[model samples]
Target: MAAIMENVTFIDSSTCAILISAFKAMQLKKTGRLVLADSPVVQSLIELTRLHTVFEILPNQKSGIIGIDGRVKFAITIIGPVN
Candidate 1:
């Protein structure tokens, strides 16, 4: 599974923790690359948690999809803040 976090300017510690948990969970069941699109906050959090080695960090969603499927396809789900 791949997650592309965009326009996320701010993220609290608790939320970061939750994200880490979810990423880890996904990692366990992942068949392909577990990619995370670049976001300064998210990248910092991942580095802080030492999960950088666990996930494949990509520059954008398109790259992430390519990294996963080796081509661009419409096979993605975008989940964002409720507000």
Candidate 2:
């Protein structure tokens, strides 16, 4: 998961669903920290997974952050345009 996430900070539609499914599968085990931009794609994924608490939606564009934490074992970033 780290290798997959390490390659990109921005997420386009092509990979969004795949990554979201990966996170959804991990929801039960709490295997990672998901940093999601509050965009339509993310909102849809959240609903699909019904795993709202597992995702940390960026509160503001300026303060958004995405980083890896070994303790969590995985990390994902859902990037969006500045609002």
Candidate 3:
């Protein structure tokens, strides 16, 4: 599975922390996490939190969708032959 976060605006530090924990959990589960941060403010926050290294930060929603599609295809191929 994959996560697509678009046009997200965090109002508080707690919310950002919560998302960080969620992203870590997603990573542990081998889930693809993509963030669509077209806003400079959002990008700065992500960079400040160093989450850009943790998740794929895309400039637009289409990129995130493409990323998720690629990941899904890979996962399917990896699991398709399992009996």
Candidate 3, clashing residue pairs? Answer: none
lDDT of 2 by residue, 1-83 (tens): 33233433454555646656666666655565345343455455554565444444434333433344422222234332223
Per-candidate Cα lDDT values, in order, are 0.51, 0.44, 0.46
- Tell me the tens digit of each residue's lDDT in model 3 across 1-83: 43334444554556468667766666567654433434455556656776566544543333433343333111101111112
Can you tell me which runs of candidate 1 are displaced by over 4 Å?
27-30, 33-35, 60-83
* lDDT, residue 76, candidate 1: 23
Residue 7: error of model 2 in Å?
7.0
Residue 38 accuracy (lDDT) in model 2: 32
lDDT for position 24 in model 3: 67
Please report, as a residue range, the 10-residue window in candidate 1 with the lowest summed lDDT: 73-82
| lDDT of model 1 at position 82 | 27
Which ten residues in a row are the worst by lDDT in model 3? 73-82
- Model 1 local distance difference test score: 0.51
Off by over 4 Å in 3: 1-10, 61-83
**Model 3 error, position 74 (Å):** 23
